[model samples]
Target chain A: MDKVVKVAVDAMGGDYAPAQTVKGALEALEERKDIKIILVGQEKAINAELNGIGYDKDRLAIVHAEDVITNDEAPVMAIRRKKNSSIVVAMNLVKSGEADAFVSAGSTGAVLVGGQLIVGRIKGIDRPPLAPLIPTGNGVSLLIDCGANVDARPSHLVQFAKMGSVYMENVLGIKNPRVAIVNIGAEEEKGNMLVKETFPLLKNCNDINFIGSIEAREIPGGGADVIVCEAFVGNVILKLYEGLGSTLIGKIKAGLMSTTKSKIGALLCKPALKETLKSFDASRYGGAPMLGLNGLVVKSHGNSSSNEIKNSIIQCITFTEQNINDKIRMHLEEE
Target chain B: MDKVVKVAVDAMGGDYAPAQTVKGALEALEERKDIKIILVGQEKAINAELNGIGYDKDRLAIVHAEDVITNDEAPVMAIRRKKNSSIVVAMNLVKSGEADAFVSAGSTGAVLVGGQLIVGRIKGIDRPPLAPLIPTGNGVSLLIDCGANVDARPSHLVQFAKMGSVYMENVLGIKNPRVAIVNIGAEEEKGNMLVKETFPLLKNCNDINFIGSIEAREIPGGGADVIVCEAFVGNVILKLYEGLGSTLIGKIKAGLMSTTKSKIGALLCKPALKETLKSFDASRYGGAPMLGLNGLVVKSHGNSSSNEIKNSIIQCITFTEQNINDKIRMHLEEE
Candidate 1:
């Protein structure tokens, strides 16, 4: 029998806690028999939600955590003080080698802080970036340092490129992903101080297949497999992309349904349009992995649904199976 | 008769130069009687293109500029060495009080440099931001400092907000425009060094209607009338918005044509969808104005069509009539 990949999930995290998290855990187990889940939250709440769902009892376990980290609390303080918090306890499972991965849909700051302080970093990793797979025209591109490490140096961007390349290759199964640094312009001379300093360094690195600078505009057209930037720029690009996508989609839908003639056309084109738009939905790719961490740490959205949670938990299986951390470590050492 | 808004246009600029520029000039003259265009470029090429179009010859004049600035040449060097370049000559017209505004589709760097160096900044104006009107769900929002000033300070951002608010209110007729600083998060303390420093300064400034910090994701939803940020962030947002808009539009069109059912639906809804999407087109809003300059200098896209150029030329009329520059000077002096 193949080894079961155990993923510790924070049941008390996210907006629809325990219920959605518990349901998502049960769904993930049913979908993959080789997956084991350790749901960490208030035992009674988790148990009440899990009672109706029938799943393999052997594969699911509950680790009672007394405290729950609220989104309003400061991240570092919460992580430091709340030792028995669901986020901290779930992270502990990964730190102690009790679980191969940890997934959370909680406060972003807390997840990022806990991932670094608890799971720790792999050797030679300066900063672990939160790399999310953003949907593009052709497929998906990994946007590294989406939120973590707002003040990243040139070397940190280089490491992000390497780690991003490894994740895209091993987990997403893309061969030799094209890596590009995000800049204001395509020219080498263009961009601010950080991009100007990092451009040549990325070009000189033999590890990454560095395609010169890429403008933010080319990002949506699937310009590169891995897009590297400092956290501030990356975060801006990610948020703008998300905001614009939803806004545009909403506008298009409204336009289509406004008139009787268009409404009839909309009904006929609904299936095809839905299929086309689905390709741009980011949640299908699961949560963003905090790359360069010693153990897998994934952060799902705060308002993640059952499907997103399930996808996030199942996503950890590939991280364990492919040994992404070890590959990242090897890549860093080689440089 | 109203005072003719004299505009010096670089006839030798852009991808489809002389022809597009001359045609655009003639079209602008045909559309508005109270506007005179001084086409600055190589006389032979300008006249050759002009001979084919019929317009009020009295309203259009030709100024011979011996040299043209190519996009490849270094901007500062090009401006200095190519003393008689079209961009420099046109800008000189503005400096000499012969023209109310100067419009160009040439090298952005040269235009920006020449605008500041030749036309000069208003007395208290710290920086002249290149503010462009970007399309959004509800309407359009002005994105200040899209490409001009990269290393902007908190004080510079304050000026951008003020100038952007003035432009939106006086030109676009938006009343008491809501100005917002672009940041990574909605919270007061959730940005990099620049945004952090700029946020409170903007909030405290009573000169403009300063709203709280706005995330990039909220930009496309028309969250603010004026989106203020440093040049790098603003440029990224602008380019990304344009790139993603075009990409999604292309994808939607392709999807609509793929299946027979969709094709039928697309045919039926083609007029409505086209009308809806056209409103979001950035070109309708005219060129990006280099705010805070003594004389209005606008940069149209390098690939601008005749329609865009015509719009850009007509746009100068409003600036001349409303006296945006003098209003900006007064606003800055108050602070």
Candidate 2:
């Protein structure tokens, strides 16, 4: 008999919660026979959505949670007070070994907080960073510490580089993922104090493939497989990437719609152009994982729809099956 | 007669050196009558280019400087050894009250070093930051500390906020420009140690309008007029802005040229589309100034052509005529 890769999803989280999350859960089950999903939310709401779609009952189960965590609520306060919230309950399932992985599209703060406080960090793990798969020209690159921990030390960044490389190689199926420190300049001596200190340390590490400094411009070109940085710089790069992509798309759409002649031209080029632009859509990459935790906790976008939710749940299956957390523990133990 | 703005141009610097620099100086002279230009470079090269273009001799003059500083040399070493270099000589003219401003398309490190060591800083200035005008939806916003100093402190960031605010108000015609600390999150408690320490200091300042915090995504939406941060973050933002813009344009061009149908569409939208995209071009914004210096020192792009050089020279006219340095001094003194 094959081992079951069970995932606990916060069905009442995210913008399209319950409907999209439940639909996504059903999609994941249909795609993978070896996977099981525990939908944590109000049982009535989740079951109604599941029944509306006529999902497979044998592969899907609902675990009731009384409350939902709103995006605006303070992370620590929400985790402390809302113990029975969908996010907390889902993480608790993972903690109790009832589920191998936890996925949430709820408030990022709450998700990150719960993943650490409830799911807990692996022993010897100094910091758990949020690593997101960012779309690139070649395929996708993992950007570690994309706004999980802000005030990271040089040591934390060093750990991020190692953990990020391990995840990319073992889970993403990349052979010897190249790690690079994001900096203002390509030269080793050219960044702020944190970068200057971290560069030598990253260069000294022998267990993983360590490339030199990477400028932010080279990121979209697939300059490195695993881009490492403190959360502040990583967050800026991620936000900037999304902002620029959206702004350009908006501009292109506006330009194409402006005049009668342009609109006619747009119609002719719509199919091919859409395909080209779709390659850069971040939603296709699903959620970002908070690495170095005892159990896998993936944080999806708050506005994620059914497709993104479905992709995220499927992503957790792969993460669990690959034993990413165990590898992270071994990597840390080696140090 | 209107007040004449005198701008000292470093014609012996940059990739094109005297040829493009001289042509640019002539173009600026023709466009604005209330402007006098001092072209400092090798006399023969300046004369050769100047002789090719017809302009009023009364508005333009050449100041001889024999030495040249290459980009690869250390900043301080280049500034010290090449005393007669165009950049150094032009900056000296500003220092001696013979010219109102100095402009160079030369090595950025050389210009920054010369701006501080030659032109000197305003009394009470903690550190002079390089501020550039970035194009946005609401026109343009000034991003301070683009490159002048690295490994900046919380105190330096505070001064940058004050100086950037002054420059925007007095020179850029922005009224009470809102100053925002570039951060990973909008909350005060967020960000690295530098931002945490700098946030309160900026808020306490009574002279400028202070906004709490701004994420990088909000920068292009006209979130704040003066975006203040250390060199590391500021440089990343500037580079990413340029990179993303260029990359998008490249992708669009590649897409349009790939097929016959798209080529036809591209031809139809050529004029209007070009006009729209040109507004976002970084080169059109002229040069970035090393702020808080006693005299104006503008650094143009390394690959700057004749038009960019011309625009930078004209930009210096306004920088000098506005007496921006005095305003910065007054703002600091009052605080």
Cα RMSD (angstroms) for every candidate in the order listed: 1.5, 2.8
Candidate 1 segments exceeding 4 Å error: none
For model 2, how many clashes?
0
Tens digits of per-residue lDDT for model 1, A1-335? 56799999999889889788888888899899889999998999998998777788999999999999988888999999999999999999999999999999988889999988999999888889999999888889999989898878999998999999998999889998999998877788988888899899989988778999888889999999999998888888988988888888888888898788998888778888888887877778788899998899999978788888999999998889999999999888876
Candidates in order, TM-scores: namely 0.97, 0.92
Q: lDDT per residue, candidate 1, B173-233, as tens digits? A: 9999999988777788788888898888888888789988888989999999999988988
Clashing residue pairs in candidate 1 (N, C-alpha, C atoms within 3 angstroms): none
Per-residue lDDT tens digits of candidate 2, residues B49-118?
Answer: 8775678989888899998887777879999998888888998999998998888988888898888899
> What's the C-alpha lDDT at position B123 in model 2?
86
What are the TM values for chain B, all candidates?
A: 0.98, 0.96
Model 1 chain A worst lDDT run, 10 consecutive residues: A277-286
Clashing residue pairs for model 2: none
Residue A2, candidate 1: Cα error in Å is 3.8
Report how far off residue A104 is in candidate 2 (Å): 1.6
lDDT of each: 0.90, 0.85
| lDDT, candidate 2, at B168 | 87
